[model samples]
Target: MGNAEIIAGIKIPDSQMAKAVTELVRDTETDLLYNHSRRVFLFGAITGERKRLKYDPELLYVGTMFHDMGLFDSYASETERFEVDGANTARNFLKSYDIPERDVDDVWDSIALHTTPGIPQHKRPTVALVTAGVEMDVLGIAYHDFSDKEREEVCACHPRGLRFKHAILSAFCYGTIRKPGSTFGNVKADVLERMDPTYKRENFTEIIMGSAWDS
Candidate 1:
């Protein structure tokens, strides 16, 4: 078991299941995704610690590991959104270990809603933390929450490459493009918009502008 202080007193989980999932992700996804998944757990744990939120480190680690699994062909669905696919995969994986149904659902929700803003925060502590971690890594949504040293430590381990933003976008498209309809009501829809010129999504900005109450 390998553990490191991702933040002051917080250590990354390195149990057998953690190692197995890490290896599974590494073997299935590219370096960009492998590193991103690991960082998601680290960052989520950091936020959970900072907020003094009660959480299960091992379960959170599992959720984060499988959060993006749907992006790979092994788990991808031609109809369901990758998020749901990933969430279902996590649920199925944890069941194999006889994880309690309650905890399994927590991990499932964590992966399913990691991409949806504002809602995960209202779910289980682990789910909110998982969402926080993804937003932090992908969008720098709360980058300032961590100290310079903490940020650097995480970056050192995960090392967001020079083209990370673009790479993540490309990765999202790779997963969802084959099933573009899967992105219909979520942010993943933006990937289809960018990947396919003719694919237009419902635009909130336009909706607000055209609303009868405004302008």
Candidate 2:
């Protein structure tokens, strides 16, 4: 059997795979988005376990971890395209990394249709399960405080912390949850450009006020 086949048949070591993906995403200049993506992967894995998906847990984890790998390309390009290009990027990267075809398609489909919203109704059950978890992750991004046990709205590791607040603020500011065909590139550069280190905490509100990322 090939390397990809070996990876597919066994459980992937989380730290090892996560390190590689983290490096790849960090280099792409989407560190915070990458962090959130990792959380989505974790959430997806747990949801898959709970839902009894027949697929390998490792496959679900790895696939979801790299779902937004193409976000970098989308960010760099001028067209704001994501689905098709993101899938192509995933295909190429997985092929280069020797990922198995079935597992590859699993990730590709999930990434391609992630922002499509309505596409979930027709997706594979596992995809739908993962999607819901990812959505919750997005929803919990900036607003949910994990500390208040009695609140009962959302849950996360460090709710109400800086990371939690940043994510929540990001989701409210950068989230594109239900809208379809919303490309990050199509967004005005002035918006995301302001998200740079120079921007103040309150600047997110101004920058994202009328942007598609807020959709």
TM-score of each: 0.89, 0.56
* Candidate 2 similarity to native, TM-score: 0.56
> What's the lDDT for residue 183 in model 1?
82
Candidate 1 RMSD computed on C-alpha atoms after optimal superposition onto the true structure: 4.3
Worst 10 residues of 1 by lDDT: 1-10
**Residue pair clashes in candidate 1:** none
lDDT per residue for candidate 1 within 1-215, as digits (tens), equals 24354444467677778778878888898999988988888889989988999999999998888999999999987798898999998887776686888999899899999888889999989899889989999989889988888878877878889999999999998888777778867998977788777776776687788899946
**Candidate 1 whole-model C-alpha lDDT, 0 to 1:** 0.86
Error of 1 at 153 (Å): 0.7
Model 2, position 136, has a per-residue lDDT of 56
Write the residue-wise lDDT of candidate 2 on 5-116 in tens digits.
1111233334455456556655763555555655565555545554566655554554556555544544323333445455666566666566667767777777667655
RMSD (CA, Å), candidate 2 to true, equals 10.0
